[model samples]
Every structure is written in C-alpha cells, then in structure tokens.
Target: MKTSAADTPPRKRVIVLIAAGLSVLLLAGIGVYGLIQGPRTGPPPDNSEADGPAATAAPEDGTQTPGRIVPVERSSDPETFARNVATAVFAWDTGAGFMPLDYTAVVMEVADPTGTEQAGLANDLAAYLPVREAWVDLRQYATTQHLEITDAFVPEAWATAQAQAQPGQITEGTTAITIEGVRYRAGVWNEKPVASEHEVAFTVFVICEPAYDTCHLLRLSELDNPLR
Candidate 1:
C-alpha cells in the first residue's frame, strides 16, 4: 500500500498530542486527590535537622515525641523564663500542623501571663503570623531553630529595687530585665532546592512586678549577625 505525504500524520505531532493528553490527566488527578485528602500537615523528611540532637535528650529508651511545640515550663527566675520562651518560639514546625495563631498564643502566655502589658510583643506577633503562614504555603515550613542563653542580668534600677527590699516587703515593678543569647535558624525547601542558615546574638527585655507575681515581655531587640 502506497501512502501519500498528506495521508500520514507527522510523528512529531502525534507524540506532542499524546504528551499533552497525559499532562492534562496528571494535573486532573492531582486536583482530585488534593480535594479528597485535604491539607497535609506532615512534617519534613527525617533527614532534616529536626531528627538531629535536640537541646534536651530523648528518653533512655530512644523514644521521643516529635511535632507540636514541646511544653515550656514557667519559672519565677527571669533568666529561666526567657530561655524557655526563646526555645519554644524558635522551635516551631508547620509540617506538624502547628497553626501560627496558636503558636503565637502560647508565646503570649509565657511572655505576658497577666495579659495587661507587652504591647510590643503583641505587635510583633501580629506581624509574624501572616508571614509564617505564607511561608508554609510556599512549602518552606521545614526549619530548625536553636537558642542558647549566655547571660541574663537585671538592669541598674531593678537591681537597686532588690537591694532596698525589706523582708516580706512588696516592691514596685522592676524597670527591666535583659537576656542575652545566641540563636541559630536553619531552613530547607526541598521543592525549591533551597537551604538557609544563620546564627545571631539576640537580646530580650521583660518587665516584672514581683508583688503581683507578674512579668511581661517589653522588647526583643538587638540582633547582631555573628557572621559579619
């Protein structure tokens, strides 16, 4: 059988048509699956630094609970309180389905138990919530943050108040308490093939009213790039 040039379809055109059909089917399948499964809060791959050594060790049996913010303990000591807050704030996992708003609430509780102060803290949370959610949507939720508190000191005014305090005496609110430390942040976007790491020194301030047993975060300023 003899075929004319116009009678046979071009091989390249046929291949292109098949490829287009397959691509469309794949896209449809993805959409359908997304609708059926809903959002996934799964964490990143185990190879992530999250699987590495934590500030605290796991049980001797080598068992550990991953995902979700680890419970932070409250302490009367300003230094202890600040360290706990820093650890929790940096150690977040969107992959574990941690909502930004909820995480912010937990931070608020630790920094401002009385809820009557710390306007700066509130403002900062408001700004961060949206940015974090957007980053999570971009598949940039996998991250590791570590904090080490180098020193915590009471300011001059606060120190003076402590010195003047009599036995069983109630003192006015402390002017400020400062905590100095270093923080490490690492992030990976496997999809984008992007990785980032940074270490910086940070300072945080808290105000306390010992009489009411209340403390509120005032500021978290002063971040210096260690690499610089």
Candidate 2:
C-alpha cells in the first residue's frame, strides 16, 4: 500500500528532526573556532604570527639593571663658584644657570676665602636700594643693600639678569687659572653686550664640587659710575 502524509510513521519524523539539530550544532562550533584562531587583518605585515603573544625587547647590555637609590653632593666648584656669583650679581641667576640667591645664600656662596669678612659684606649689602641712580661696586653689588628682597629667587633672578644681559653677537676670549692641581683656561663671555645692563663687565669662572657645579664671574678690580 502507498504511504500518505497522515500515514507517515512518528518514529521516522523524529529521526529527521534530530539530524537537522546535529547539523546546526556542527556549523556553530566551526564558526566559533575560526573567530578565535583566524588570521588577523591590519596588523604589521612583518608579524606573520599575529595569532600568538607579543614579543619583548632586551636592553643594549643584554640584561636589565634594577634601579638603585643614590644621594646628591652639596659641595661647590671654584670655577663654577666664580661664574655663579658673577651670574647671580651680573647677568641672570636661575635654573641650571646662575641662581639669584638671597643675602644669606649669596654671602654663603660668595664669601671672601681670603678673609672672614662676609659678615661685613652682608651688613653693607643691607645699605642700599636697587632703584638708585648711582654706580655700585663689585663688592657692594656682591652685597645686596635692599633686604626688602622683592625678588631674590634664583630662577627669577636668572630671568631678570638674562633679560638685562642683552645677548650680544658672541665674541671670544680666554683666561687661565690654577686650582687644586688642575690648570684651566676658561672661555670668557666677553662678547660685546647684546643686552641693556652693560653697567658692569667681568670674566666668568666655574666652580665644581665633587657632586655639584656653580658659575661665577671674577670680582673686577675697577668700577663703572653709570650715573656719571
């Protein structure tokens, strides 16, 4: 007898339904695997193995050195000392450059090694104002008169001095000095004044400590009377 739609067996229909479900599950598994291990598109062409982890680099020494804690030295350099003092008083004192220190700090740094008379210099620096219309001596200028100290900060002073030290088309000169078994011939910034504060001029010196460095200018033997 021929089979009709209503006469089809329930067992055969159940087998067909199970086969369709298994086929769908197989397709989903393959898609999931491809998503995870599939070839990457836009990464660097050199990295052919993009499916793996990134590689790291080694240092030039072939090994990494762990960081160590260290300390700083606070001593001074005679050459840098001279330059720093001069910079503090003359050009600009601030930053890695000359630092415009306060009366105490300036006296401490610019003390006369030839004499213990910085106390006197400090007292003298307290005697004048910065707004005067007269010429100030190296020693007196070394000693700041006005303790009002409106602007004795190092960076600020450096900016002020640099602003005052009109940057001249740099000229060239040299000077030599002997200190602690070392002879040095320093290049002086004696170039023509490219600035407004040519009220005074002096040679530069550098002071170095075991751990630090400072700049200063020589104490000029003569003085300029700007008001005259």
In terms of lDDT, which candidate is strongest?
Answer: 1
For residues 100-191, write the lDDT of model 2, one tens digit per residue: 23423553454433222344333333321121221121111222111111111122222222233323211011111211211111111222
Tens-digit lDDT string for candidate 1 (1-228): 112334322222111222344344344332122112221233322223433332122123433344556666666566666666666655555444556666777777656443433454655544333344343443233554556667665544334433444432322332333445555545443323333444433334454434225444544532331101
C-alpha RMSD of each candidate structure in angstroms: 27.0, 38.5
Worst 10 residues of 1 by lDDT: 30-39
Please report, in order, the local distance difference test score of every candidate based on alpha carbons.
Answer: 0.43, 0.24
| lDDT at position 214, candidate 2 | 27
Highest TM-score: give the candidate number: 1
Where in model 1 is the C-alpha error above 4 Å?
1-67, 111-114, 126-130, 155-175, 187-197, 207-209, 214-219, 222-228
